[model samples]
Target: MSQDRAAGGRMGDSSLLRRLNHAAALSAFLEADSLTLRELRAVVGVSRPTAEDLLSELLAEGRVEETAPPRQPSEARSAGRPARYFRFRAESGYVSGLDIGAHKAMAVVTDLRGRTLATHRVELDPDLPAPERLQAAVSAARSTWTQAHLRAADITGIACGVTGALRAAEGVHDVREGPFGSSLAPYSLPGFTEIDVAAELSTRLGQPVAVANDVKLAALAEHWKGAAQDHRDIVYMFAGHRAGAGVLIDGQVHQGRHGAAGEIGVFPMLGWETAVARLHARGAVLAAEQGIEPGREGELVITSAARQDPESLAALIAFTEALARGAAVLALAVDPEVIVLGGGMSRGGAIIAEPFRRELAKLTLVPLEVITSAMGADSVALGAARMALDTVITDLLTVPGS
Candidate 1:
């Protein structure tokens, strides 16, 4: 991940050297309006020979590929030299991104450039036990394989985004706590075991699995592909049956020390807990009218609200306003450049953004930009697949015989 970089700053002596050494390799592959070795060398104040070496290294790593445009040889060069361009490999090996939500799991197969090729979704019994639920996610991935028209070998890696705090491998409570304290203590997920899920999925996929909070993954997707692209710091908030937020600082997702940094739902608001309960209770009542059991685990009380049934829409607006109140608190503290609204209920970003922006303006003096996520419900899944791709690419770089 990139660190906190000062934009538009004058290049320092050593910094210029480093940038020149790396720019040809990485920037060349990325899409740009126009680029050339001469231009890159000029930016770094390096000699032509040094620039040639940098380009050579990039070509050796297969990071950049040269292409010749389809044109008459006479048109190809105005002064004498032929024009050759470079592009990042769009058809590189595939990555599988997965999102394990409370009631559903979705997986998307994408290329190195993050273009989706195929997708798969599955409805799971939210009331079922944890291991069984994980197995359902595995099944979803396997089904996606066929849908994508790719063999298992074509899948380079898998990334998983879940809804809980994941402890480091050493922290599992496999033993009793000592006089000081042991790493192994039971971590709870209402219907799943975190360790078990990670272990089972890793084993089933035959590759390492990265499990992170779902909202964090959503924030990552926004940072990678949504309105947050211009801002290095951002906060992604979702208002639904459950409310949550994700933080991104310096282009990296901030999970905090314990992975609970963005669980904004637990943060106290003005009678927020009560209001949320009432909202869910209202949803349950409505679901009952449709013959859905009030206590069913997968029952979407909030989904029903966001569908714009007159009374439900009214309730949802109140919730969005209340959510804005919570966001105001975050804005005052972090002061990020933008806040992205996401999740199933956030479909009407225009409606929600207008009211939330109005409410936020009343609370803070700082200029805050609010926008909706382009990835929407697919954010976590895309992020997960990216995680998987990272594992495979990283191994290919480091392992002796990958």
Candidate 2:
């Protein structure tokens, strides 16, 4: 019996090693567009036979495929036969992300590499009931996968970004109780904490769904592919209809014990609560002067400021000054490498950047490099897609039946 137990342990050890090798090889392919057998062997630190075996397994699973090697320069080209190459089948599976906000519900379907294949957006009424709002979000996601010409089953992962702070517990109420409740909830949707957002979306979409605060996800998106890609520590501020912040420490998003790490806007003393109102008030005046509808006051103000309208520019400065107050608090606490301004208002370009930076500089001890988001309105959704892609990769690397 002891001999049999020892033999079982040896077999288990061998299986673990094989699994590790398989994961390493697949990870290499995922990182690069393509790889040769020799390169795979070196990357996985395995024998030629083991690399070939791993490749066969991946090929059988349709997660990898043979591809033509790139043509080399005439002088660098070898005289011998060319090496064969294999590439990860990014199209073998898909992932999706959803941004459910007060104004709209946007969804994007991406390949395994987080490339957006299709996106769909639906305008939503903030006053819509919780159940209906969730349905709308799921429908948008479904539309994206359908537009990508893929079935629901083809999507291996899904993540959604929403307005309220998410707790660490699985099904806890997301809405805060006091005056500090979700900023957008009063103006947009109601009773957001009444339902299990992830569970409801998962049930409707027929897949597991990961949910996070929209601002935090926007920060993640910026780090992944936007303005902060070069920086490891960052402060992402969402300056749109509402003001919020997301923090990244050492390249990882910092979610506090309650998953509300960067919620500085909740403090009235911080001035974020009044920032957007100031912008809207200025925008309303600009819209009236321009003879446009009043509801788009924010856009009007931003555009007028860009054109160097004196009143608009002054109002923008005031708005940024208010924004700087909250940002200063975050900067003092985190000391990030950069502060990235994202959201709808960031589209103001230099009109927004200059004042925001000028104001932030006055309030902080260190001169913070403030940049506007290049991702614009799509940052949150793209960030959500990154979250989904991360989930997919995690599952891919995991050994089956482990």
Candidate 3:
């Protein structure tokens, strides 16, 4: 019995080594696009025999394929005819990114490399039932995938960005349901109270779907591919339908104990809720309710009106000040290098940026910058994609022999 147990341990050790070798070989091929046996051996730091065995495993798994002889990077590395090269089958899997809001639902399909394969957007009827609205989001994903000439089975994972407070233990809570007097986001319908939105999307899409706060996701997008890319630590102020923030410290998003770390807008002293209330009192909210559109429309009206009327300009400045005041608190706490003004109000161009900077300068002695978000509205969805992409890659990396 002792001999049998020892034999089993040896088998397990061999299996583990083979799995590690397989992962290394596959990763090296992906980084180099394609690799010959000799090059792969050098890249994975494996012997020729081990590399050959790993390649055979991958080929059998349909993950690597031999293609036409591409030009090699170096010559005379080996003393034989050029060996056949193998490339990763990047098409073996797909991923998706989704942005869900009361106003619009958008979906983007991407290959394993996170390249945008296709995208689709649909205006939603906010008055619709929650399940129907969610289905619309799922349909949009399907449409995008179909446009990419891919099927449902091809999608390995999906990530969604939604307008709400996402708690780890309880899932998401839409801001509209909170005690705030003002409707900050374009939250048209009554929202789900305590639903596992990620699980819901995953069930509907037939793939793993992860969910995150839209503003938080937007900040991530900024860090990953937008203006905040230059800085490792950033405070991204999301001024869209609602006023909030997404903080990145040391290149990772900081989610507090309850995922409410950046919910500064809820403070009555900061004037986020009051700012919108004041704007609504000035007839901006009326325009939105009167079928003018949601999100950016009210801001545009405010922007254009501010240029001509003193009241509009004063209101805008007051709102901007409130936004800056909230940001000052975060800046003092995190001391980030840059503060990115993102979300709906950011689309106001210099109109929003100037006032925010002026107000922030008055409140803090910190040497910080206030810059407009270069990512615009697409930040959340793209950031969702990036999050999803990172997750899928990590998941793949963890799988034995992947």
TM-score of every prediction relative to native: 0.72, 0.89, 0.83
Q: Residue 363's C-alpha lDDT in candidate 1?
A: 88
Candidate 1 lDDT at 91 equals: 54
Residue range 1-402, candidate 1, lDDT tens digits: 111122124344455544534653454445453346775456445567766776666667676566655455665557767556555555557888888776677888887677788888887655767776677778788788788788877777777777654423343211222224522211223455434566677898887566766677778888777767788888788665466677788987775555555555554554455555666667777877787754431135445544656766566567677777777777777888898887666665566677778888888878788887777667888877766665665554442311
Where does candidate 3 clash, by residue pair?
184-241, 185-241, 240-344
Error of 2 at 275 (Å): 2.9
Candidate 3: residue 246 Cα off by (Å):
0.4
Whole-model lDDT for model 1 versus the true structure?
Answer: 0.65
Is 2 or 3 the stronger prediction by lDDT?
2
For each candidate, C-alpha RMSD in Å? 7.3, 4.1, 5.1
- In candidate 1, position 166 carries an lDDT of 40
lDDT comparison, 1 vs 3, better candidate: 3
lDDT string, candidate 3, 48-161, tens digits: 787788889888988889977776467636677757888888787888888888677888887876677888898876666678778888999999989999989888877888
Best candidate (score: lDDT): 2
Q: List model 2 lDDT by residue over 1-402, tens digit each.
A: 332234346666667667766787889999998999999988776777878899999999999999988777899988888899999999998989899887788998999977889999888775778888888889898898788999988989888888884545444335455343445222334667667787888899998888888888899999998989999999988878777888999987887776767877667676655667777788877777778854567678888777888887777787777777878889999899999998888887777778788878888998888888878677888888998888789988997654
Compute the lDDT of residue 400 as modeled in candidate 3: 61
Among all candidates shown, the one with the greatest TM-score: 2
Cα lDDT computed for each candidate against the true fold: 0.65, 0.81, 0.75
